[model samples]
Target: MFKINNLSVKFIILIILFASLIFGCTNNKINQIEDLRKNNNELNKTDTSSSPTKLTPKNTIIDLENTDSEERLLNNIFSSVAPSVVHINITKEMDVPSNQNIPDSFGFNFGIPDEPEQYFERGEGSGFVYDKEGHIVTNYHVVENAEVLEVSFIDGLTVKAKYIGGDPDSDLAVIKVLSDPSILYPVQLGNSDNTFIGQRAITIGNPFGQTWSLTAGVVSAVGRTMRSGNSAFSIPEMIQTDAAINPGNSGGPLLNSNGEVLGVNTMILSQSRSSSGVGFAVPVNIVKMVVPNIIANGTYIYPWLGVTLSNISLDIIDAMNLDLKQRGALIINVFDDSPAANSGLRDSQKNIEVSGGTITIGGDIVVSINETEVQTSDDVISYLVKYTQPKDTIVLKVLRDNTIIPIEVILDPRPGK
Candidate 1:
């Protein structure tokens, strides 16, 4: 039994020694593999450092430097113009119909009569300082029927404002801020004529009651005509932009890249009543003509030709038996006892049916005014709005009876001036 135990112990010791030898060999192999990998990596690094071949990246990298600079530029513009912009809040008094006769299901009055309720409605818009004299320019609709006007600045300074005057024809109004002159910073107005499409447009206003918001876009178009809600005439030479103009953006400044006021943001064309990227502004040129007159007098008097004009159309040309290449403003009707009537300007004498519809014939086609060719009614209207004033004499070249004739007419103040 002693001899067998010694043999078993010897066998176990041999097994243990064999296992250790196998493990040691496996570990040495792993270490050698690791060393080879390390050497390979070192050789690659040395080659890369000494190599002259420039490795081009497989992925395209966009440089965001210009984008970063653009953001900074917009931020700078907002900072500089925020002080000049103002938030306008108006309280309008309205008469609500009294519910005096509260009728029961049996159709009999069940309540006593009460007086008409006076409702005070709150509204908000935007404007900018016009001059050091505290005159602030805004839309006419913003202050229309406003019983109380409150203006707020960037520093949260709220002050009462008195409506100096408003030209509903141009949809422009001026209100005198009842605040200290130190808080007023008048904005620089740019020439709307110089504003071109694709140029950067920036708008700073209180959109959706969020005071002093900024929106940036490009001028989509120029020389657009917008109809005034309170005037018979349309505001001409408007600037159209794609900036996100909402309800409270009306009367704000649509600025150029130079931080100059290109126009006053007036309206947006949207079915949702929110911004759909289409917006219009009353051009600064019109503001230039109308604002000073509003400050000097009680209103801005617009020049009137006292004739209803329409663009020359194919149907009208066919009906009037005119040349197909003819293009001008067609006088549809002349107002009685007005400038066009006093100067013997002819109107349509008869109606003739055409393929499209009926058109009036025998009216005078205005080919030119003041030596400038009139291709459309807009041309005539734009010319008068920009160049002529009330009582200014203008010569019109009219095509009548297959012959061109010159007529002199003195302009008069538009109705409701």
Candidate 2:
């Protein structure tokens, strides 16, 4: 017989397979990234023969025809975005040699040492004006552990910015420069809900230190959820695009055809560390959800269930003789002061003496919420999110032993006290 470790590995493989089946690709995209980049360097650049007049005519009345609507749209989009979009340069601390250091004018130390080299993790990305009061939006991972921030715009203006607020759960940050409101060109917000597949999208950013560049593509998709920089939490309702968002594209505006900002381009799913036709933008909806809280309180809040859960195994269900027909979140741990704790919901984690021996207890399976069926834990949470406030109450049907019990519980906002 094979070892138990082998059986565990097999079980793990099966779970991963199940997850993949549940979350498969929405569509099979045809990647022409290579073909597009093959001559992109030459594509943007055009050269004219030394003097066409010398070869042809003297000063022909070049009655340059009027620009088309597309050109006008592009020009307007770029003009509205050029002033607000800014470049970000970050310096993270790294250990280096202590002795090998050099000083600058006001005496900023940086260099290599004899024993170890003192290092600074310097990197660059971009951001855009998020508000009128000098506030800007960017990716959290871009300046996660940054020490200094330098922002630059297209008008040859650069300034040192201050880290105002950030949320790692959503992978967003808010920064601000010390400047007048008129100097900052705030981007006009667009309704992401208005964006549909095949609608145009434009992004302006400093990719690879190349500043104030614009690229366009159609809205590839909407409500695309993925696990990108936020490894712990799933960034939900993402906007997927084939818009060629690259390394420095993070925090750039994802604009609609009407020159309105829909989202801030954040993550790219690529095999070669570049835009591979699979790019994701944190939906402006999420930005709108988190930005106000971050600006006011320096933090963002999420809805929390205040309980811990673990996937129930088939073997455990069979051994416990629990009802197998019911499907929902199996409660594992409930906090002492949680909403569930005051709802008369019993946590099964109690040691009991049957007759002379012992009994182990924990959590019962939540089979349903209200009249709606809880197919999975996600369904339970999704239903709760539809509620406008936490004061609302929800009814849960739980299966314990061979009997079904109803439990009513009040909800509370996450990141709670």
How well does candidate 1 match the true structure, expressed as C-alpha RMSD? 9.1
lDDT of 2 at 64: 30
> After superposition, which runs of candidate 2 have C-alpha atoms over 4 Å from their true positions?
1-68, 96-113, 116-118, 306-407, 411-417
Model 1: CA > 4 A from native: 1-67, 97-115
Residue 225 local lDDT, model 2: 50
Best by TM-score: 1
Put down candidate 1 lDDT per residue, 1-417, tens digits, no spaces: 456688899999999999999999999999999999999998777555567866668465544476777787887788788899999999999987666677788888876645547879999999999999999999999999899999999987999999999999888999998677887899998999999999999999999999999999999999887788777889888999998899999999999988999999999889999999999999998999899999999589888999888888888877778889999999999999899999999998788877777778788999999999999998988999999999999999999988999999999989876
TM-score of each candidate structure, all chains considered together:
0.81, 0.64
lDDT by residue for model 2 over 1-417, one digit each (tens)? 966798899999999998887666422222355556667966667567553454546455433358887877887788777888999999888885446667889889876434544468899998889878899999888877788999988877889998988888778899889987888888888877677888888899987888988988888887665555654445656788888888988888898877788888998888888888888887787788778788898877665556655445554455466656646677766777778888867665755555436544457677787778866665655455333356667788976765779988887766532
Candidates in order have lDDT scores of 0.91, 0.76
Q: Candidate 2's error at 185, in angstroms?
A: 1.0
